[model samples]
Target: MKHGLLWIARALGLFALCSWLTRRELRILCYHGIWDGPGHYGNYLFMSPGKFRSRLAFLQDWGARVLPLPVALERLAQGRLPARAVVITIDDGWASTVAHMVPALEQAGFPATLYVTSYYAHNQRPVLNVALAYALSRWAAGERDSTLLPLPGLGQLNCPAGDAIALHRATDQVIEHASTLADDDARQAFLCSVISATGLAQDPVWGGPAFRLASRDQLREASAKGIDLQLHTHRHRTTCNGTSCLAQELADNRSWLTGVGEGPFEHFCYPSGQYQASDWEVLRRQGIESATTTEIGLCRRGENPYALPRILDGESLSELELEAELSGFLTMLRRISRR
Candidate 1:
């Protein structure tokens, strides 16, 4: 009932009025990675390229005025935002930003910010979560003996070494293993080895070298093509790593990112949306203009720029659901429902 009403309200131009009235704020759309081909299953890091294109079309057809993130923030601060203004921000600089997402955004003429997590860029490994999920998927697809399976650093699981059903029982072990790694490179190596031992693929993940952060060539080329490469952190670590550790990560991130990225790096996205309130002090000290979180809300003026909220856009959010959210009706409903 509520969804239908929201859709009707959007069609009837009610939210259009809201957009006009609320032009002082901005609607920031956050996305992760984009997959090129169909090897990834259950990978929430990105959507398929086809799906991503369709989303851009939806925003255009719905009359959204897409702006680069930094430009949008500046306009909002000046109280000169356009009605129906939206900003595109893709977190985690995967190679797909060059292979798949860039062409699509160029086609739509939409400017986007690609926040690169520097550790993967600095080291020679793919992101850990991708490797972890890949190993689990590989284990689940093959036949093996009925015995306990052991994982390094993440403890042992009673997973049937050769049975899909039994392997399915050990899924949580994969997730826990990925999270406990010392750093991004360590996690990548550990998980990639697991995939190799399982005989998952002859070529291995990211076509072997295609994974990891955007290569220096990719970063240089992307910036030349008008796509913005920004900061996600040197290691995608947040305040959970202690203040000094976090500071080092930022300094390292800015150093390498500026080495390849165009001009100054002023924006940030909390790695995996994990952060503490005191992290703002670190951001301000670094001269960050804005920082986005996984928190759900619209960005209003005078809000803490370091802790701004964003709506996570992914496969889990269907087109209709996205329409409702972008229409800004769902936020209104939540406010009334809470009342």
Candidate 2:
């Protein structure tokens, strides 16, 4: 039904009309990693390099004026935004992104901001949460044995191999426990245990460097190559934990990021799109010029700078869906439905 509607909207020129109407609004595109793993694994967190290249082609063909994030935000405030202005943002600073996405962006001569969550980057490890999710999803059907993987304090991770909710609960428990481990080495050992238990230590997503964050040197190289490195918090968390947690995350994130590049590192993206009313003053006090969320829609003047929206361009989104989104037809439909 939705696909049919989109086709009809295109046929009726609604896409064109919506694009023209929202041409002045700022469209921030959010992306994550580029998947270089063997075979096709459909994950929202990663996409193939070819897909990313095609996305850049789409932006160019659609006549989008890609601007540096900071410049775009400044222009947005001054109402000097060009028609179909777009800001391309990448989250997490994945190794694949630096190896694949950054090169693609540079080849296209487009400016992009990378929101780097410092912990994994500095620690040089696969993100624990992601590793757990992958491990749980791939644990064999009959291998529901809790004793397969054991942690010192977190006991057994007994979970239904097929029940997603149960698996999520188990993952969370282990994650919380992993956080309490002594050090990065301990955490790495824990992850190794998980990989071994799932018998997936040989998988590229688990064993290879693909799932890791870009190292400090690689990030520096990307920065040198013109990718704007920005803050995404030290641990990929937000103010929901409290004002102090948010403050520490920012400070640590800033400390690591500043060591990588030059000055003016001010933009932020909420870790996991979590934010609240009380967050505005905290962010303002911390020198944050703008903060983006995972919220969907075009950003316009007068909207809160601390909670700007973005279009999450990911593996699941098709080209037609991307067109509908960029043209503002999807945003219009969303707004009408909300009313």
Candidate 3:
């Protein structure tokens, strides 16, 4: 019902008018990995390649000007942004990014910034937490055995089969233990045992690129192909653990990115759109030029650089809904509702 009203608004050319009014506001688009494999693995985190291509098509059809992130921010601050200026940013450097997203961007002749978290990149392993969660989520509710599975070196798990919360708790327990493993090999072995216990060892997602981060070689190749590589932190975390921990994250992030031969590495995206008030000073201390959040809005001059907003494009968004975002219709509605 609400979608019908949105379509009506678009047909009435209200989106066009709103877009014109917000022309000076910078529109930042945030994306994650592209997933083309089987089953529903959540839309926002890993969008389908076809949907992403269609989104790029929509941007072209809307006559939006795509700009590099750093250049767009510079122009925005100087009050020199073009009409419908948009910046594309991909977070986490998923392995699928190099395989799927980069080619699409290349074909479109659009430049994008990839904010990579180096932990997985350096380790060259499927992230333990994500892998376990996905494995748990894919198990049929009915097939979940209520019996506790015993794991050596980590004690027994009494995960209630069909309960999402219980599965999540079990995943956390495994993750906590896996984190203590001495190396990726040990961790991989541990993961295999858990998957075997869950009776999902044959699931194709494990063998596929679904849970992997881009390899170091692929990252270098991506940068060489005109993808601007940037920082998303070393460990993909934001902490209340103090400025020093945060600073080390950036240092480690930059340390890995240096191998990519791209730099100044000043721009950052908060992991999972998470940040705090005190983070501003932490970012400032690190010489971060601009930082983007998952907040949905258009960027304007004089807003906090550390908390700049972005529209998160996902698989579930219809073409019309995306048009509303790119055309600034949604932003206008949000403002009006706040009044």
Highest lDDT scorer: 3
Instruction: Indicate the residue-level lDDT of 78 in model 3.
Output: 97
Candidate 1: where is the Cα deviation over 4 Å?
1-21, 39-44, 141-156, 159-189, 196-199, 202-210, 240-244
Task: Point out the higher-scoring one by TM-score: 1 or 3.
Answer: 3
How displaced is residue 121 in candidate 3, in Å?
0.7
lDDT of 3: 0.87
- How would you encode candidate 2's per-residue C-alpha lDDT over 1-339 as one tens digit per residue? 878888999999999999998887999999989888876453568898999999999999999999999899888989889999999999999999999998999999999999999999998878887876666667734454453455456666667557767767877887887778898788878878877767777776666777699999999999999999998999988754445488888999999988696647789999888888787888899999999999999998887999999999988788889989999999998889999
Alpha-carbon runs more than 4 Å astray in model 2: 40-42, 140-162, 239-243
Q: Lowest-scoring 10 consecutive residues by lDDT in candidate 2?
A: 140-149
Model 1 weakest 10-residue run by lDDT: 203-212
Instruction: Encode model 3's per-residue lDDT on 1-339: one tens digit a residue.
Output: 878989999899999899899999999999999886786676888898888898888888878799999999999999999999999999999999999999999999999999999999888888888887776566534364454767767677776766677777877887889878998798889888878877887777878878889989999999999999999999998764444477888988998899794788999999899898888898999999999999999988887999999998888988888888888999999999999
Pairs of colliding residues, candidate 3? none
C-alpha lDDT values of all predictions: 0.75, 0.85, 0.87
Give the per-residue lDDT digits (tens) of candidate 1, residues 215-247.
Answer: 877877888888888878887786553444667
